[model samples]
Target: MKFYKISKDSGKKIFHFNSNFIMSRVIQTDKTTNIGCMHLEEGGVIGYHQAVVPQLLLVIAGEGYVRNDKDEYFKVQSGDAVFWEKDEWHETKSDKGLTAIVIESVELNPSLFMPLKK
Candidate 1:
């Protein structure tokens, strides 16, 4: 499996990717465990999508709203954290901007997703 060193800052080497929304993965784990950070631009909205694996998102900066397919929604701001599981449909919106840290862990085998190398 692949491993990446976690850093507090996004460096020039960081790869940009488009998931539910445009995001930059800071540190990514190729094992069952994963960690990452993302910057959501102002007025950005992450479309409804299911994560490939279970994840936890912690708001690091800015404000936003997270919505699920079940019609449930929640306001998200700095210092808030949300749990996301594989195959669970959800979306996110940022009226201003948002920076978040995401973490994930899988019990079974995992796949590697390195940005830019593809």
Candidate 2:
């Protein structure tokens, strides 16, 4: 699993047409893609399993822990994104509640866009 930062601090400031805002690029895929939100209540867990395709989990709210094939858990919070390659084993767990947006696709390549977590 690879960790990336999608927080506003890593975003680009946009001042186009007298508009002020920050844009954090997520992903661009040409192949078929699936996007969904995942809500985990306290002590919730997404059991370890093989990723059917390249998967990117973007934590939008709350905090959690994620593990890859090595079974080492990494803490993740809002604005954090985790990527797993196809067939990679992974899992997610939360002690408190957490909400995330999950993106899955054959063409998912987050490294090309988001900066690695420092």
Which sections of candidate 1 miss by over 4 Å? 1-21, 107-118
In terms of TM-score, the best-performing candidate is 2
Q: TM-score of the candidate numbered 2? A: 0.73
**What tens digits encode model 1's per-residue C-alpha lDDT throughout 1-118?**
9876433344222322233344556655667576667666677666677877787777889999998677777889997877777777777779898878777776522234322212
* Residue 15 local lDDT, model 1: 27
* lDDT for each candidate structure: 0.67, 0.79
Candidate 1 has what TM-score? 0.67
Candidate 1 backbone collisions, by pair: none
In model 1, the Cα lDDT at residue 61 comes to 90
lDDT of 2 by residue, 1-118 (tens): 9997655566555443332334455565566787666666687677777899999999999999999989689999999999999999888888997777789899888989999999
